[model samples]
Every structure is written in C-alpha cells, then in structure tokens.
Target: MHVPDGFINAPVSVAAGVVAAGAVAVSLRGARKELDERAAPLAGLVAAFIFAVQMLNFPVAAGTSGHLLGGALAAILVGPYTGVLVIAVVLLMQGILFADGGLTALGVNITVMGVVTVVVAYALFRGLVLILPRTRRSVTVASFVAALVSVPASAAAFTLVYAIGGTTQVPLGKVLTAMVGVHTLIGIGEAAITMLTVGAVIAVRPDLVYGARGLTAPLKLRVNGELVDAAPARDFTPVAARSPKKVWIGGLVAALVLAGFVSFYASASPDGLEKVAADKGFDKNVEEHAAAGSPLADYGVEGIEAARLSGGLAGVIGVGATLAVGTGAFWLVRRRRTESAGAQV
Candidate 1:
C-alpha cells in the first residue's frame, strides 16, 4: 500500500527514511553482482511493468481492492538486489511524478514493499526450488507460493512498525488482524500474477529468469542398462546477456493496452489500504498529497475530454517515467560494478 504523508508519525517516517536510504545503499553494492548489460535494460522494463500492473487494482473484498506488489515478481524474474532497486525506482517515480505515494513516506514504502518482500520471497523461492524437482513447473509453482507468502509477511512488518510508531490510537490486535486478513486475500492475487508472469518468461526465455538458472538438469542416460546422470548443461552466459527484447516488447504492448484501453473497465473503488484506513480510522491522519494540483493528480489528466483518455495518458506517462528512472539507476549500478571489477584487477 502506498502510505501517504502523515499516516505514520514524522519520527517514524524519518526513521523509515533512514532505513530505506541504507537499503538503497546496500542494494547498489549487491546489484553490481546481479546486473549486467542484459539485465540492466530488463530491470527498467520490470519497473515499468510493475508500474503498469499496479494501475489495475483488482477487487479483493466487497469494498477493498489490491494490486500487484511486484517485489517477488521482479526478484524472481531478475535478481533480488536488482529487484529492490527496480521497485525503489518505481516508488521514486510514483512519489515525485504521479504523487501516488508520499515523498516523505518513500522510504517506508520501499522498505516494506521493496526490500522486505524481495528478501522474504526470494528466500522462500530458493528454498522451495532447492527441495522440489528442478523443473520449470517447480519454479513456477515456487514463484506462486513465494509471492503468496510475501504479502502477508509485508503486512506483518507494517503491523510491527505501526505498533512502534502508530500515529493513531488503534488497537494493535485489530490492526494486525485486519492487515493480515485482507492482505492474505491480496496475496492470492499476487501469487497468481507472479506465477503467470514467471511462467510466461520461463516459457519464452528461460535463460533470462534468474530463478530459472541451472534448471536444465542433466538428463539421465541408460548406458548398457546402467542409468547415469548425463553431462551438466554448459554455463553459456550470465543471465544479463540473455536478450529479453521480445518479452520487453510484449510487456510494453500489454502495459499500454491495460492502462490505455482496459483501464476503462477497472472498478472505481478505493484500494485495500485506503479502504482499511477509512474503515479503521487510520485514514484520518492522511495529509493532502504535495502534487494535489498536478495535471495528472489522482491519475487523471486535468480537463481531458474523457475520463478513460485522461487516466490512460497519465498511466502511460507514469510507465514511461518509471522505466527511464529505473533504467538510469540500474545502468549506473552496472557501470559501477564494471569499474569496481577493473579496480580489483
């Protein structure tokens, strides 16, 4: 959930800001190992795709809706460190440009939605993949389960944070139950999206999926009635070299279609966090967004001829900006990695 300004007390938000800053710093170093020429561009596309999909909030309960958190999806598709950076980029763009998330709360959102989710999901994904049959199906299944669990884990993290620095007097018990219960439902949607996307990428370019690496297990060969493991597959190239150009093009087209054409049919209901906050009284502390007067405020272009067109244009702009910012950050990370390797040499 995109926590706007004032929901969390100023001190708590600042603390989260510090934590978020540290996370970014560490992620920059970690991502050097994860990103290369190939993953650099795909990382940008992943951020844009997350931005686009997040625009389509699906109904979870009668009054509340949930959208893709994208950390698990990004981490599984790319790498965990790069996934954190990608999501951070998307959050940065949404805060500064679309005013979706608050500027002050950027760190909170990134920490909860970006860092925590990636860590939890990636750990679970790796654990499951290690135990399960090393097949594409297993990878997809693990992705689904990892994504499903990560949402509730994030909810628990928020509750812990709120217990420490909640702005309101809401009971911790109520907050935990509501947050976990609603987010569990949201987790199912997250699982489906993560699984489907992972499956699609694995089907087309298994080489590019970070989680799918080394999945081409050596085939068993029967030689003179004795079965033996065949030679292991060669490590032709790292993940970044695998061109995701086709997947990227297809994703861009889908993003445009969803935000441009399909978004017209999306429900007008407030999302999960908004609904929960309103019903539970936590929304009272929400201050107005800084970009309240922006032309694309509220995801609608001011004075546009049609609501659909206005929203669509805003979505497109958001996607493009997110991609650019994400790509720039990732490219720099790659450059730093290259330079560091050279220095070591």
Candidate 2:
C-alpha cells in the first residue's frame, strides 16, 4: 500500500526515511553477490514486471482491491536483497513519476512495503523450502505461503508505524483489524500471483529462478551399463542460456502489454490500505501529492485526451524508465563486483 503524505508526522517519517536509506544501502552491498552478468539485467526486468502487474488491481472485497506486492515473487525469482531493491525502485518510480505514493511518505511506504515484506517473505520462504521436499513444487508452495503472509506482515508494519506517528486520531484496534483482515484477503491474491509467476519461471528457466537453483539434480548417464551421476557441467548452459535476450524481450513485452492495455480492465475500487483508511476515518489527514503536476501523474499523460491512450502511454513510459534505471543500477553493482575480484589479484 502506498502511504500518502500527512498520514504520518514529520519526526517518525524522517526516522522511517533513515531506515529506508539504510535498507537500500545494505541491499546495494548485498546485491553485489547476487547479481551476475545474466542476473543483473533480469533483476531489473523483475522490477519492471512488478511495476506493470501492480497497475492491475484485482478485487479483493466488495469495495476493496489489491495488487501484487512482488516481495516474495522477486525474492523467489531473484534473491532477497535484490527483491528489496526491486520494490524500493518500483515505489520510487511510482512516487516521483505517477504520484501514486506521497513523496513525504516515501520512506514509510518503502519501509512497510519493500523492506518488511521482503525480509519476512524471504525468511519464511527459505525456512519452508528447507523443511519441505527440495523440488520445484516445494519452491512454488513455499512461495505461495510466503507471499500470503507477507501482505499481512506489511499491514502490521504499517500499523506499528502509524501507532507511533499517526497524524489523525483513530481507533488503533479497529484500524489494525480492518487492515489485517482486508490485507489477508489481498494476501490470497498475492499468493496466487507469486505462485503462478514462480512456477512459470521455474518451469522454463529453473536456472534463472534463484529459489529453484539447486532443485535440479545432476544429469545422470549410463556408464559401463551402470547408471551414474554425471560430472558437474561448468559450461552446460540451460534453456535460458540459449538466448537470454529472448527471455528479457519476452518479459518486457509482457510487462508493456499488461500495463498498457490490461490495466484498463483492472478493478477501479480502492485498494486494501485506501479502503481501510477511508473506513476508519484516517484518510482525513491525507495531503495532496507534491508531484501532482508531473506529466505522468496518476498514470495518465497530461495532454492526451483519450483516457485509454494517455494511460497506456504513461504505463509504457513507466516500464521503460524502470527498466533503464533498474538495469543501470544492477549493472553498476555487477561491475563493482567484477572490479573487486580483479583487485584481489
């Protein structure tokens, strides 16, 4: 959920900003280990994909809807550190470009949505995967459960933040219940999206899906009429290796299609957080976004008359920008990793 400005006071918001900055800093360092030549750009695609899917809000309750949070999905597809960075990038893009999230509350949104969700989901997912069978199915199942819980965990995190710096007076108990309850329904949708996305990637490119990395056993061969495990193939490339460009192209196209066209059919109802805030009367403190004058504010082009065309153009622009920024960020991280290794020699 994108927290708007004025929902939280200045002091706590600044505190959360510090926390968000620290999280991003740590993730940048951690991502160095995770991103390689192939994975660096793919992680960027994950961010763009998350941005596109988030534009398609599915109905969760009669008056409420929810979209993919992408914490578990990204963490499973990529890794936990990169997942945090991915969500943070998406939130940053949405805030500055689309004016979806408030600039003042950017830290709050990142803290709750990006940091909390990734940490909780990844930890739980790893635990589950460790306890369950080491198969693709287990990875998918763990993804489902991890994603489902991450949403509520985010709700609880926001609640805790609000408790400390809420701008308006509201019943904390009711707010917590409503936030958690609606988000629980939202979590189901999150679970399905995460499960299906992870399953699809694992099915085609288990080598690329970070969570499914070790699931595949070593190739077996008949040696002297006896079945034996083959030697580790260092240069043995998987399906994704045949053409990494194709996968990136396919992913970008899917993201472009979803955000450009499919989002038009998405539910118009308020999302889980907005619904809860309105119901609890805490929306009263909401302030106008600082970037409300941006050309792409509210996911629509400023001068485009047709709602469909304007929205589609904005979505396309968003995807392209996110891809560029995310890819560049990861590329630099990868470059540093390479440089570090070279310096060791």
Number of the top-ranking candidate, with TM-score as the measure: 2
How many clashes would you count in candidate 2?
0
Tell me the spans in candidate 1 whose CA falls farther than 4 Å from its real position. Answer: 217-242
Candidate 1: minimum summed lDDT over ten consecutive residues — where? 235-244
Candidate 2, poorest ten consecutive residues by summed lDDT: 235-244
Model 1 lDDT on a 0 to 1 scale: 0.86
Residue pairs clashing, model 2: none
Model 2 spans > 4 angstroms off: 217-242
Cα lDDT tens digits, model 1, 102-206, are 888888899999999999999999999999998999999999999999998888888888787778888779888888899999999999999999999888788
Using Cα atoms with residue i matched to residue i, what is each candidate's TM-score against the true structure? 0.92, 0.94
